[model samples]
Target: MPNKLVIYIHSGEPTQFSFAIVNGQNQLQNIHHHHDLLPQESFEEIIVIVPTEDILLTSVALPKMSRNRYQSALPFALEEQVIDDVEHLHFTAFDYQPDGQLPVAIVAHEKMAIWLQALDALSLKPTQMLPSVFALPYNEGQLQIIVESNILVRTGRWAGFASDRINFSQFLHALPVGSAPQEIEVLNFSDTSLAASQDSLFTYHEKFAASADFFPTLVQHALNSPGNLLQGPYAMKKTTLWRGDKLLKISLCLGVALFSLLFLYPTVSYFILKPKLTALNAGIKRIYQKQFPKSTAIVAPKLRLEEKLKKLAGGGDKGGLNQILSHLGQAMQTESNVKLKRFDFQNGQATIELTADSSEDFSTFTSALTNQGMLVKQQSANLVGTKINATIQVS
Candidate 1:
């Protein structure tokens, strides 16, 4: 909602220009021209619209050059040619499309942008630079009339059509005013000579004005319209324009990273230190068992030992003593003459007392256990009167 100035530079003459000051409402406040007198100090800011070719074509043709070359070529060329030119001009460019055919480039130069930065360094307010076309309403029903350096084109709906139609560049040559019309009025051109053939009967009315609020209306229309892909250099300048404060995009990114670290710290610590914690817990239990060996139940001691080893080595779940006893019973059951009397598991060893028909049965049991990766040590094997008592150590 700030006052904006639309300054038009004469084609080829960078210094000689005409400016029209308009308010937030798009109402013209003042219009003036300066030719011989150079601006002593830069105005709030300046927006230069330079004519250039499409960036896509430039990229396709000049593939070896940087992408910026497509946009920078015009300004670079201008700065090289013009003497005593404003050295601090900030600008961008876009292709200007007339009648929706081919696009010519338009660049905007902003002296005000540089001036404002200087002021900001000394703690002062800076002037804002807005697009000249942005001030006009964007409604297709509401005419978007542009009066630029003796050129007048009306863009609006005709018949049932609902789009911007730029049909007239002829009015630019028809003006016979002093020099040429530097500042043109934006109004409905439905009644103007530039209207479509079907609306040729419409008559010009001086009282016709825009139908809606200028800024918001245009903003909405622009949002809805099939916008130009190649923005002139002025568009580029506007992107880099000072908006009073330094952007903190990097700081925001750092903050997000820090927040993520806060959430991830516990999970990472748990995974990294889990084995050490388990080993520590197992060592503590082993120390407890050693201190009070008699007080601990015999079954509880072995279970605790298994748990400690599993925790320390990060091993899978181990079967209980019952499962091992059942496996031994099944192995012994395979021999019909072996009558299992007693079985014991102590210090990683299994002891068995059985009444076997012969010594050969004891040999077969030992061979089966040995084949299953058990380290067997024969403690005693007495085969007397068809009874065998065998004690073995399985490490």
Candidate 2:
């Protein structure tokens, strides 16, 4: 996109705005002037450069004057109190004085200035927020000489012959025309008619030329210059126009495709393999029935047996059997004459056999098991030589 350029209209008695584009060599290309009433909303985007009385006075050779004298003499020339409602005013002075008593000038308009700032906030382009006088200065050449009077005329050799006549006032600054040596002459024509008067208060330097038809020539020179004024609004209307939801649209499409595949694939698989899966399940059930004749009745019993087996194998149960065995062993107080020969566990029953040297020894052993919460039942007993074989069931 091409760069944007904006120029704001100043506010004054006869306020207006003009602009021109100039090249690196400072030659004007195009010029345009605007004096039409602007919309209130349009004012928000414009940067106004209104005239003011506060002149920036400085000289290359002149001494700096006291602040009191400066204030008394200048006292901002623009009518400020009349337009106090306007906001956002700023002022600066550029002095190019080579002799005594430099002129002071201030540009302002608070409301219009703030409105232009609002336009900047909205990212609009405003290349130059300049006063009408400063803008008019560029209508000619390297040295712009403007003579403000009852007749306003701009004359310059390089500017190629142009003059303009208009109502003049002390409140306005004459536009700059021509270059350094080209003296800009200002004559007061408010009092006398030039046709009948013989006394002349205005004359020109040897380096400058005089002309009566300078306005149209000045305008033509501005048009022919290297720079031209930009048209329309300051900023491009649709540079980075946003378009949302693009990624969301793609994701939605993918999700729909995946959903369709999930349902369709599952349905297709079921139709293709349903019969085979059913046959396999039936065959497995038949094999199980053949292997276990009392399968229905013993299902619960088998679960109980599996649990008990897990406990015996030291896997699922928490050391309860070990604790019971340790307690029983501790309870069996050993009589020197009695010795345990074997211990066996089978089908939820524990068997203990002992050989005793005397009947007292046997009695003591039986009493120990009884005291330790074991249900003892003597299954068989035999005496042979010095050994006694006894089988006891511990429940």
Candidate 3:
């Protein structure tokens, strides 16, 4: 149980499948009781019980090494006994065995390929696959037998068979006389002619509700038993502990998130930058107001400065503050050694304060401004500690 799903697969022309859900106490809680389910339907992990005839369980002796290396040698170890090509068979081995041999399950690749194709259509992949005869109980010194319409017997762990009534007797009588188990318990669900004729060697259990009722027992054992057929290439690939349709849903969720971001990013950026742009415009208007105190209405800062300059030019103040600043910027543009420290202008006149590398640099800057048609006056001139400092007026 332990919250697992069990599926019984019968070998037939089209194949038959039965499913059951079991809980922690080995209790069968639910049975979907339907077949040929749609492709979109799937489970997290499932235990599969295929008819014993579909699989071959045997033992192979292997040297101690990494499991992968042990598996590499399995085809050769089993090659002589198997009639089919070793490469065409699917081999899966169990964990370390108390015996000298390793328990392995073998199936033909074509058979497994057909089963996988059908399961893919149904969107179902079983994590564990085993022979259905594992459902028969096994006890030491006692042989458990269920000889109903079909025969089922558990001789050892991962050792059992499913057969028709005819072959059942042949297999039973073929057992060596001295090798017979000390005790035998037979579960009766139908006519038990084989056990009744030899009641001396059989102990019968009372009948159950119906033969089909024992199906829950089979499924429960499947949940608890080992010998899963998935190993190597057939092993279910895990994606974050999720598989089947769940992984597809997770991928679709991530794609939706990325698609939404394409539109969301620009909208988020616009809201974030709009406020900062407004703050910058406010700073520009404040500087414009400091230059022209008479104008109270503020609109465009660059156009407003040009208008103020035109008004000052009409009153004979060179062109305007803009023209004076433009000529000063142009004069300093080519003179990297001359650095402007501060500048102020008022009443059609500009006072410039700056530092220079030498007095020649200062003379070169003043001459450049004079050539631009601005009258320049040297108000103060001197050499500060390390560089030259000077003050001048322009109109």
Q: Which candidate should be chosen as best, given TM-score against the real structure?
A: 3
User: How many angstroms is residue 149 displaced in model 3 relative to the true structure, after the best TM-score fit?
Assistant: 4.8
> Which is superior by TM-score, 1 or 2?
1
Considering TM-score, which of the candidate structures 1 and 3 is the better prediction for this target?
Answer: 3
lDDT of each: 0.44, 0.43, 0.73
lDDT of 2: 0.43
As for lDDT, the candidate ahead, 1 or 3, is 3
Listed in order, each prediction's TM-score against the native is 0.35, 0.26, 0.54
Q: Where in model 2 is the C-alpha error above 4 Å?
A: 1-90, 95-104, 108-124, 135-199, 204-395
Residue-level lDDT for 293 in candidate 1: 74
Which candidate number maximizes lDDT? 3
RMSD of 3: 12.0
In the range 1-395, model 3's lDDT, one tens digit per residue, is 23667777655632566778766666777776565442233345577777677677777888777889988989999998788999999988877677768877788988777767766666676778777677767675455676555667776675656667667656665565754564566665565455555535535443433567666767766766877777888887774545657878889998999989988999999999999999998888788789867778776778877876677656434647777888888999857789888878777688888899988888898999999988999999888766789999987
Q: For residue 390, what is the lDDT in candidate 2?
A: 84
Off by over 4 Å in 1: 1-5, 10-16, 20-32, 35-45, 48-139, 142-151, 157-200, 206-249, 252-292, 295-395
Question: What is the alpha-carbon lDDT of model 3 when measured against the actual structure?
Answer: 0.73
